[model samples]
Target: MADFRTVPFLPTAFHDDATLDLDGQAALAATVAAAGVDGVNVLGLTTGEVTSLRVEEIGDVVAATRRGAAGLPVGVGLGPPGAGTLALARAAAAAGADLLVAPVPAGSDPLAPLGEVAELGLPLWLHHHPAVTGARRSGDELAALATEIGAAVVVVEEAPPGDLLAVLAGGASAGVGGLAALFLPEEVEAGAVGTVAGCAVPERLVEVVARYRAEDAGAAWDAYLELLPWLRLEVGSPGLRVRKEAWRQRGVLSSGRVREGAPLAAASKLAITRRLRQVGADVSAPYPGS
Candidate 1:
C-alpha cells in the first residue's frame, strides 16, 4: 500500500483570463511552484472552466504546469471520459505530468480505465466534485476503486466540508478540497492520509499541517479559523478569479482575470477585500477583486 500521509494537493494557479496564451500559463505555473506547494492539479474546472479550454490548450496548460511544479508532481485533471479523456491522458504523459486527477465515472468501469493509465505508469488521484459532475461516490466506493486499481496514490476532494470526515473515517486515501484548509486537523486526527485545498496559500497550509502534526491542534485550528473567510471569498462561482487576484495582490502572479462567466464584479472584489482584511492578509494594495 502507498502511504499518502504526507501528500498535499495544490490547485493550479493561473491568471484570470479567457485563454492562457502559453506565456501567461507558464508564468503562473512557475509562480505556484516557487510558492513551495507540495503538488499541483491542473486544467481542472477550478483554474478555469474545463469546457472553455481547447484540447490543444489543455496540453499547453499541462506543459506549463509541469514547468511550474519543477521537480514536484504536476497532476493533470483527466475528464468525463471518452476520446477527450484518453487524449488528455496521453498528452499529459507525453508532456511529463506526474499524476492524473479525475472523477470516477458513473457508467464506466474504473478498473479498465485505471488499468490503461497504470499501463502508462502514471499515478491516479481521484477527485470528487459532486456539484459539478453530479456523480457522487462514498468513501467505500472510492476505497474500493483505489484498491481494485492498486492506486495507492489517491486524492479525494468532496464539497460540503462536514461530509469529508465521514469519508475519511471510512478510510479514503486523501481528503482534498478548499475545505481541507479548515478541516484538515480533524481529518488528520481521524486518519486521513493528507489533504488538498484551493486557498492558494500553500505556505499557510504547510504551517498549519506542521503545527497540527506537532500536537498543536489549537494553533492549527486558530490559523485555519483565521483563514476560513478567505477561503470562502476565494471560492464559489469566481474562485479562480478571486484566488488569482489574491496571488497577484501578493505578487505571486501577474493577472487575475478568469474566462467568460467568471467575472469579478466590484461588489465581489470589495467582499474579497473585506474578508482578506478581516483575516489580516498583509499587502500594500487591496486584493485585485477590491
Candidate 2:
C-alpha cells in the first residue's frame, strides 16, 4: 500500500528522434524525487499516448523510471482488461512498479475489470474520471468501490481534484494533473491527501503541499500561486511539449519532442522563458535552432 503525498504524474521522456530516452526518463524521476515526492506515477494518464507504445517499450519505461526513483515508490497506469493488460501489469511490476492505476469503465460496475489486475499482486489505484469515462460516481460510491476492491487509494479526476464529495465519503483520496494546482487550498481543505501533477519542476508543488499540510496554508497558497503561469501552459493538442521543453532547457532532457509532433506554440515558448527566469532556473542555452 503506497500512501503518496506529492506524487508527480510523470511524462514519458523522449530523445530528439522520438525514441524513449532512458536517461531522460531516469532523470525525470530523480528530479521529482529530489523535490521530496512521496511517490511518482507514469502511464496512468499516459493512456492518451498509450497507442504509441509497444509492450516492451512500456516495460523499458518502467525500468528506467525505477532506476531514477531513488527507492521511492513507483506506479503505472493500466487500462481496461485487454488481452495485454496482465502482461503490461507484469512488466510494470517486474520493472519496479509497486501499484497499478486502473480506470473503471463509465456507467458500469467499477470493479468489473479489477480482479485480473489485483491478481498481479500489486495494490490498485482506482481512477474515476467522469469527464473521460462518462459515469460520475458520487463520493460515497467512490469510497464504497475503493473499499470493496481494497484499493490503496482512489484517484478522482474532477475540479479541485480533492473532490470534496469523495473526501467526505471517507476514503483515502488523491487528484491528478494541472487542475489540482488551481485550487489546492480547496483540495486540501476538502481533505485530499496529495496531488499527482506532471511537471518539469515539481519542487514548487512539493513546497505547496508541505506548507499546506504543515498548517501554513497562506504559504502554501503563495507557493502554488507562483506556479499558476507555468501550470497553465498545457500547450499542443493534448498538451505536454511545454513541460518537456522545460525539462530540456533545464538540462534534464535532451529535447521536448513528443510522439504527437505538435509544435510548441510561439507564445508558450516565450512563457516558458519568462517563468523559468522568474524562478531563476538555469536553462541550457542554444539548442540547434533557438
The numbered model that scores best in TM-score is: 2
| Model 1 steric clash pairs | 16-257, 16-258, 17-257, 29-68, 269-289
Worst ten in a row by lDDT for model 1: 1-10
Best by lDDT: 2
- Candidate 2 residue lDDT tens string, 1-290: 12327776788888878888989889988988988888888875532255577888988988888899999988898754356677777778887788888776664655656777787788887776566556677777777677777786776667755554435434454433334355656666666666666766678777777777677878878887787666666433444677777887788888888887676766767677777766656667423333
Candidate 2, pairs of clashing residues: none
Candidate 2 ranges with C-alpha deviation above 4 Å: 1-4, 46-48, 79-83, 160-169, 172-180, 235-238, 286-290
Q: Local distance difference test, per candidate?
A: 0.62, 0.70
What lDDT tens digits, residue by residue, belong to model 1 across residues 1-290? 02323333433334544446456556656655565566666766455455666767667777876665567777777765445676677887888888777666665465676567667778777666666656577777776787776565345455444454455444535544444355565556555656666565656666666666677778878877777777767656667777766665655556666566545777866776677677666554574545
Model 2 per-residue lDDT at 91: 76
